[model samples]
Target chain A: MSELYQQAIKDLAAKGSERLAVPDASSTLDNPLCGDKVTLDVTTADGRIVALGHVTKGCLLCKAAATVAAEQAPGLPVAQAAALADQVRAMLKGGDAPALAGLEPFLAVRPHKSRHDCVLLPFKALAKALASF
Target chain B: MTQSIRSIIPVLARAGFHYLDNAAMAQTPGLVVEAVASHDRTARANIRRGVHEMARRADAAYDAARQSVAAFLSAQADEVVFTGGCTLALNLAAAALAEGLGPGDRVVVSAAEHHSNLLPWLMLAKRKGFAVAVLPVGPDGRLDLADLSMIDGRCKVVAVTHASNVTGAVSDIPRLAEAAHGAGAVLVVDGAQMVPHGPVDPRALGADLYAFAGHKAYGPTGVGVLWGRKEILADLPPVTWGGGMVAALDDDGIEFLEAPHRFEAGTPPVAQAVGLAAALDWMGRLDWAEIRAEEMELTARLLAGLAEIPGVRVVGPTDLAARVPVVSFTVAGCHPHDLSHVLAERGVAVRGGAHCARRLMTALGLDEGCVRASLAPYNDRSDIDALLAGLAEAIQVLG
Candidate 1:
């Protein structure tokens, strides 16, 4: 039994379903190795993200990451959200976990280097979407 | 018997590594490793146009390797051109063949081709102004050549894989060969997946050209073979140019050597080629019929076991007819990567994802890709049991 697929991750992955038909900015990213894709849509106001939606067709790690992004990104400044993504990226590379409970479950993914991108795909998409803002 | 074969490969001696990733790269035997090391130690010198004794020895070793590859393909020594790998070999063929094509011409390729075999022609078509017509695959993952009109008068070449790396379904090469020849187009078969299993005769398969990699056939990496028909190669221009390929050079112009030499550019992978030849020699001496029977038996067992598992859907042909030992499947709720990770924890080595056949994956409706377990001669019942047991645990853990 791998700790990476714990009940908390599975619950978050099951909640990975929110999409905005129209948004101020949107970006799609794919893992060229496995062909897993994540498309994120964002709407911002007053230099802060007001709403976020994502359509992720990927593994549990990718879905869980997207769910966490959707849950924590709203009502936060764009730069802070970008920082969160960077923190997740840093944590996957053996750095300290992000100062958020949703992302703490992904600490088990640190050693599996190939799957680091799975946890970072939505975060990368979030950064890309925020960059357009 | 399997233990004896396993003993021949140094890496397989490791106790717990159940390697089911032969489709990516097979384990190299000790004979091939020694052949490469011995060549690098004793005969390491530039090939062709050298007066030293070391260069003479290098030339002899390289020429002998070419002859061995020729024998493996049932081809002439002058018809084989050694390339960096299978991708380069296919690119060499595509670039040279594209010269005869134009805007209105068409090149027919199957949907089951690896990216290496498909991308070169697609990229060449964009630059050379030719149309690429894709042949669709049936539900069983075999090419559906029912509509022969795609190979009409404008067809210039028919490029396809001899066996699909993802689905393991073997293509109907004779039918494809007849169609290509009927339309006055040449048939180029990507034999990378097929050659590792056994020797092949390109002429017998009615292919004008064939390409395969050495690393996938229990040989060293960085070496591959591109075998073409004598007359067809004689007429094609060289896609690359370098020292050994030029027979005469001046300020006015340059005259190239004949077919094989004209296509070989730069210093080739001499030691890798020597290792490939040694691998092929070892394969030739094996009882292929017995090995193939054992492989098919395992395939049958795997298929039956997969069928009994709920939510496991096979992506290729279900039976032992016209397929290799490669098996690909998908679980309903579990992603291939997740399942692969779980299986890895159990010491099972399998490949997940598109397997470099994205077009086929799209056609098969595998949005998240599928898990693939490919078998070689060295694998035994223990390997399959480990794979099945690992999958059960993976589903329980991830599903």
Candidate 2:
């Protein structure tokens, strides 16, 4: 509703950068009542992400999380993907996470504690891809 | 004038029994305090405890209330077994009939049943290894009974809802009952929605058993009536036991009481019963058909308005000609919760999400869920207009 929130949503929607990360498997998180769902695609090729993407529906936070997580941890290993999910989770929670370039899109999301998982969508998808492998 | 949101609304933001969002939690009227109030003042003693003046009075009130509920359903007082609520009543029906069945004993259930009706039967089949046949509903959310013909011979019990809580589509219960009976299965109707939508008479419906919740019908919470045939009640097994459910016990085993008591195991919700009785008594005094017709008019108006809104998909029957005021819908490209949130901000109460019929929604692939708007006789035309305005605003916000 605010200008920053609107801007953040627009920036995420632009989704200028696309990446095929190493970890191919991902986890899906569904908020049943809100009907917000995100599947994180995690793929591990030789124990590293070779490709990553997400299919999601919900609020701006959820969409932004998927886009940010994918850009941050695609080429990383299982450990790196998990760690990045943690960072995304931290950023969503208003906790401190290192300033990875693409992750800056999520800075607007920090104050809303309730949206932590929504902002963590992409990485969760990747985790699932990894878990399955 | 619209009924504006006096405060923030409820949101169904998660799953589980308490998954109702802040909006839903906010919208739900609290009856616990009210339930307690009646308990201390009237219907206080163990109802029908007997032999004392106070007990005698309580017994008369309670038993007479039972008779009233029976009459409400066009049944005999002895045929009604008051349970904790709809859930327990359904469990009573399913578990009782499910007992003593061998492998291949079939149970037929519609996909539109609420979790209260579906789960008990599912558990019964899983535990007993009976054949469970699930029938589907057409897009209108009513049973596609042409598909039901396939369930013949295998169905030991046919369980379905009188009206879907999610979609508000009224099922043809009498027809379904006939089909089940022809197949040698008893028909169990979950009337939670129907009872609230309008008055209902289960005996006339020819259903072997009917389960309805008091709260939704303007009665107190935690009290419900399950009306079954006198013969059917005698045949059912008791799932719970305590002071009243039993007649006598020996070293050999425990002997249960007859009809209602056999199922009602403990200290009943006395205040809740009294309140439910009061609600029923109040309802009986009203000209009900007029109330229902007024509600139908309101629903028709709401449905027409919703139809005019872009991206709105009303999920129940197309024939607004044959349904309750309860309605369900999904907004294309917007999650139901988002739509619900926008409306709540405007103070229009609505139910969002799967509505506890998880498997049915899954089968329909409406897993994200839809928004439900249930109207009572008290709701009026202004409410419909307000709901339409609120829905339009919600769509704009999402877009």
Candidate 3:
């Protein structure tokens, strides 16, 4: 239960509606159902991500996911962020994932399987943004 | 309107409706399923031809289906022309119009139109060099009715959606018709969102062309109806040519026949048509006013619950009066996608994002978009409760 609380907090804090700054690169993703989207921007210094920023006009989940990704992605190496995203995917997909050690805040999300893609939207946007550059 | 019937639908069930994300498709009545399967085999033969028993049965089934849709919509059997879906109906109108357009003519459309309603006009405008007049919508997703003044000299046709698929705002078609008529322009309506939930009188609305899909109306997919006045159809060109659309083929070109058959190409949908007919048959038994009343109740509950959450702003009008139950909104703290996910997890189904109304969203100052909860008549009390409960849970957990 404590783990669930912590994960939920971290998960809840990441919203795509709010702009969060990243170290490098930029990207945007769309959610077609309710007509919402999140735009992610980042700046990379050296091999490390140094800043993250975002602007969004969507609902809570998109804004929260962006905020969380912004807060978490800074100081995370580009490769590590990529790896972390995969872990987050595993954690989001299954009941148990060791990569979720830092993702404990999102543990309460197990029941929302259909929305797994929405929760992962920020990372996908960031990845797409970075990949383009 | 009555109590005995209300308790039987899925919305009234304890488990609620989203486990399968399928309403009519899920738990299709045993008899209906069997009927569909049996008719599928029987309908393989040609209609209005062939003396075989199989062909006769197929023709009977097809005719029966068309009659059913006609009765359900309160239109004559000749009014319904089964197409792929609502998009096809809109496309057909555009195609017919395209045949006559030489250039310099203007087409008037609304900014709040869904892609299905807007794209065809855009394509036509681009290809034909016809001026396109985009009607504006109010900040709350209502049509800027004054824009009707823009329908002037150059306007050759008016294309508009009866209701916005995104904001659920119902446009005043009668007023729009008056403007179009005043401008001497033909009025075309995209009824995809309007026909299923509301009552419509094509003649009363004074539209030359009207189209809608069966899928959203609790009917089968791949079947839509385009209702055009007989005179208008007689004057307009056909969208496709072949099999069903032809009257006679000989030396100097071909002569086309009457409506419906003129627009339909190849072998008609047959099975889908039957399913749509069945859906329409069932729909006729319903008291639409009661359904609208129920939707209003659900809309109120959904709006109240959404409004209670901080940073959660419901888009569209605050008044539930003129609008249907399709609700779209954005949140200050959460992205609609994220919020939709949270709700999705809780077993509540909703749509999020721009809802294919980019111009309307842009005009409303919502660059990203909003979350939408489109309520169907099948949605009852428990459905609304579940949605509210899920939203509250999402807000607490994420906000």
Best by lDDT: 1
What TM-score does the predicted chain A of each candidate obtain versus native chain A?
0.94, 0.72, 0.72
Candidates 1 onward: DockQ, in order: 0.86, 0.36, 0.39
Per-residue alpha-carbon lDDT of candidate 3 for residues B126-147, written as tens digits (9 for 90 to 100): 8878878899888787889874
The residue ranges of model 1 lying beyond 4 angstroms of the native Cα positions read none
Which model scores highest in DockQ? Answer: 1
| Native-referenced Cα lDDT, model 2 | 0.71
Ranking by DockQ: 1, 3, 2
Q: Residue B230, candidate 2: how far off, in angstroms?
A: 1.0
DockQ category of candidate 2: acceptable
Error of 3 at B207 (Å): 1.5
Worst 10 residues of 3 chain B by lDDT: B19-28
Which tens-of-lDDT digit does each residue in A65-89 have in candidate 2?
A: 6666666665666676666666767
Q: Please give, for residues A1-133, the per-residue lDDT of candidate 1 as tens digits.
A: 6879999899899995667878888889999888778989998889898888999999999999999999888888888887777889899898888767698889899989999999999999989887866
Q: Write the per-residue lDDT of candidate 1 for residues B122-182, one digit (tens) a residue.
A: 9999999999999999997989988979998899899999989998999989999999999
> What TM-score does each of the candidates earn?
0.98, 0.82, 0.81
Error of 1 at B83 (Å): 0.7
Q: Evaluated with TM-score, which candidate comes out highest?
A: 1
lDDT of 2 at B321: 59
